[model samples]
Target: MFAEHLSAFLTHPVTATVLLVIGIVGITLELLFFSSGLLAAAGVVGFALYFLGFYLAGFVGFGDLAVFGIGIVLLILELVVPSFGILSVLGAICLFGGVLMAAADPKQAGIMLGIALLVAIIAVAVAVKYFRHRGVWNRFILKEQLTTDKGFTASPDRAFLVGMQGTSITPLRPAGTAEIQGERVDVVTDGGFIPAGRTIVVVMVEGTRVVVREIFEQNS
Candidate 1:
């Protein structure tokens, strides 16, 4: 009797929406901090509870779980490997599809996801504004700029690199070095490998990340 009530409550629209928000916010925090495993664990627990509740109610299936798992793998790969956002898009689709599959109806799924996403976005914005210094991105980047005498020169804005042609200094199996505008810059391919000494072009530049693509000649 208690279990039945619990399941019903968990599957309720309000409860499910709250769980989704918690899961999204928790995971976002984990990514932003990348510190102790606590945040990640908490996010996982939120998702687990939500899924378990649905499962207990017989609303979820193995296929849905598989799709969700694939989405997770793709998202992880997107973080570890740069595919120019392709993996991110596909992963998001799969994740949403999985959740929708488990939802009681399409309208309910849309409303829940929309609300959860909006709340999560606001929460993340607040967290970023207030906790900028504690972000994990700080760990990977060098904040200090050294003088020229130190033999390390700070790079100027790279926005101009777009549309510039260059040569690959090393084989880019997605990420490698390239010589652009007489400067050796670290670059990543859209999603393919370009051998060393190949002609390449800067396709896009986001902050310090320079994306390049191989140039192929067409035979007349």
Candidate 2:
């Protein structure tokens, strides 16, 4: 009968370990590379087979499958929702718990799960480092470099505005706007207030900061 074959598969630790490893690694690959959901679908199928085998053989109950399903839901939510690893940790716990519950032997299941997790970690590290074409990773990372030739500057060179005469449009209570060289420039005074409409001269230009001093008119 189908149950006989299913029971045999679950009873053997080697085949069972292979199934768990394949399931975990498939999901891991899908998460890391996003292979158009192909890997994810395969991984889901692998887990479905695992649960189906155990359930059909009467080794695991519906509640065990429910826990596993909940774990899968939590892990999927982790991809969309930012929980700072809380969801992932909880999901992993449920996932491992469900697997152990379904297994013929809890101790063997734990050992196999540990092996699967270790393999998955090593695989991810190798893929990230050696693999050049990261499917969805490219979309998240900005590989383009902004250079001067691309008309990008950290700050505009305002040195040309030095020695230019202008009038303060706002009270430069040490920092205000002034019209320099026919352009409105944000200039700061040398620790002195210059009221609006006062004549000011640009004394220094340091990066984006334009230093200005007010000019006093001479009267007879």
Candidate 3:
């Protein structure tokens, strides 16, 4: 029976290609790609493809088990634990081995890979739209910001920072630390280099945008 199945698999071109693609993508992406919305979707899709191909090739038991095992491990690693890369790799290895053992034909792998990728895209899109407007997102994002500072500088006539003097404390690789009004603040230079220990004069503070110029008050 095994020899007969091998002969049939060898004669099938499309089946072999699909299996190869699904197997390659399922294992490779699971291990190599970093965590992000797109990658997460891709990973699931790849696994689905691998499992489907496995079933079509007379490997039903192996294919279903592979899917279940990978799903559980991924859920744990993606949410429960802070760790990511290592567990993903382990799951991927299991996936690859499972597909190889169960699938009689290597070609159907490509077709399954496509199904997995598409599902991932749809899942991520739905998640983003649904979660974006929830108060949870707002609370999570703004918890660090102070309540009073949220809209204090709304009045344009009250721009009190126009003539402020500051000292550079960070290399400002164009965007670094500067001391203004006895407080350290993040500053940026537009095509201008401001080295550490330099004196800068605030020429304009137009609508939260601070324009500064280097002063040689000492060098002059």
Which of the numbered candidates is closest to the native, going by highest lDDT? 1
Q: Report the lDDT of model 3 for residue 44.
A: 52
Clashes of each: 0, 0, 16
Writing each residue's lDDT as its tens digit, candidate 2 over 81-200 gives 847668877877887789999987789888988887887778767877886478446766887778879877678789988888999999998998988878898999988999999999
lDDT of 3: 0.55
What digit string (tens of lDDT, one per residue) describes model 1 on residues 1-220? 8777888988888888888888778766866776465765676676667777788888889998888788777866865785766886797788778878877676888898899889989998999899989986677688767878878877677989999999999999989999998999999999999999999999999888999999998899
Instruction: Compose the digit string of candidate 3's lDDT tens values, residues 142-192.
Output: 455544577544343425756788998887677787888997766666558
Give the best candidate by TM-score.
2
RMSD of each candidate relative to the true structure: 15.7, 2.8, 12.0
State the C-alpha lDDT per candidate: 0.83, 0.80, 0.55
Decide which is better by lDDT, 1 or 3.
Answer: 1
Q: TM-scores across all candidates?
A: 0.60, 0.84, 0.32
Compared to the true structure, candidate 3 yields what TM-score?
0.32
Worst 10 residues of 2 by lDDT: 131-140
**What's the true lDDT of residue 189 in model 3?**
64
